[model samples]
Target: MGDRRLAIEAWESLFRAQHEVFGKLSGDFVGSDLSQAEYDVLLTVTRAPDMTARLRDVTANMLISQPSVSRLVDRMVGRGLVTKCSDPDDGRGALVTATEEGAHAFRVIGAAHGRSIAEHMACFDDEELRTLLTLTEKLRGYRSGE
Candidate 1:
């Protein structure tokens, strides 16, 4: 293969390896009582000023589709981890807000997740990490012809 193909292959290999590591860690974090996707949604809600976001906002940040988001939100609602509210901007759209319980749980879980990422990525120098981030962002955007 050409140099470009080799570079792409190398990147893909490393990405796959990292993904596997994350999968294992995620599984081990069952104590947190949050799936990786649920955690992402929680994070999004917690980071918002009102600890709430529109359904589409969370969907955009998640790895799932609209239907999947709806199902997941319903599950979360059932778990008392989140509440669905009517969106003020749109009568038909729903807003997702983390309940007080969800915020507390997310705090605990987010800390654990942060520690996990820190431990795993500790080997990379800050500059190396920044370069990798820049390269990946560039590649991601390039693939979309941005």
Candidate 2:
């Protein structure tokens, strides 16, 4: 019973921390060309080879639903931020590639966002940050069977 209580406490703390941090970070996107969701998509796509990634891969990395991602991608395509093409290796799949314009916008916002994140995270010391990273990775890895 004590262990279960402790686990619940830990989970609540983690959830609250994430919510607070995300709420603060969301402000960083104001006046940018992208929403936080769009920036997240670009982050994944820009890091992939040739600045392109499979739609499924992007969906897997995102926190949103597949249909939501599809809609967002369509909107981005219309905005000329990304291009969608039939995946060469999978006829049924689509590939998303960040356009040069998209990459430039990402770079612009990403730099400022990075600084904003660092500022918000400044409360954590290096050792605490390392431990937090390790614990979060362990939790995620366990769920992912990694």
Candidate 3:
């Protein structure tokens, strides 16, 4: 029990330290204005092929709820960061696309995000990162009902 407690405490300390460093770095690089969710939507739209994605597709790809995604899209469209169109195949389904301004904004934000991720990873050796990813994926593959 004593050893278990000690190990848990150590793990927590390391986790907090990493979080603090990453939070500060990502927050700075992402700027003070854009919320993380907003930036996520923007970047996802920008990086999508043809700068377009079906509304439900974005929600599924982002692992967010449909209503939440819709609200986010509404906000973004209001800001002129995206354009909404009816999906040609399904009129009921809307397509969200990045506007020119949004694409340009993404370019700026994307560069910053790239640099931030690169800087954070600079401390890790390739093997360490690869091992971390492998373990994470292994643990994440549980069946949905499990």
Candidate 4:
């Protein structure tokens, strides 16, 4: 019973911390060409080889639902930030590639966003940061069956 209560407390703390941090960090996107979700999609797309990724792969990396991701990708396409093409290997699957403009915007926003993250995380020492990363990844991996 004590262990279960401790677990619940820990989970609540984690949830509240994430919500606070994300809410604060989301301000970095204001006035940028991309919203937080759009930037997230571009992050995966831009990091892939040839600046392209499978749409499903992008969806997998995102926090949003697959349908929401598809809609977001459509809006991004309309904005000329990305281009969509049918995957050659899998005809039913679509691929998303960052346009030159998209890459440029990502780079510009990425530099500032990196600074924002660093500022927010500066409270943690290197060891603490490492431990945090390891624990979070462990939690995620458990859910992902890794």
Model-by-model lDDT, in order? 0.85, 0.95, 0.78, 0.94
- Looking at model 4, the pairs that clash are none
* Candidate 1 runs further than 4 Å off: 1-4, 142-146
Candidates in order, TM-scores: namely 0.85, 0.94, 0.71, 0.94
> In model 4, which runs have C-alpha deviations exceeding 4 angstroms?
142-146
Query: Mind giving the per-residue lDDT tens digits that candidate 2 earns over 36-121?
Result: 99999999999999999999999999999999999999999999999999998999999999999999999999999999999988
Comparison by TM-score, 1 against 4, better one: 4
Judging by lDDT, tell me the better candidate of 1 and 2. Answer: 2
What order do you get sorting by lDDT, best first? 2, 4, 1, 3
Where's the lowest-lDDT run of ten residues in candidate 4?
137-146
Q: What is candidate 1's local distance difference test score?
A: 0.85
Residue pairs in collision within model 1: none
RMSD of 2: 1.9
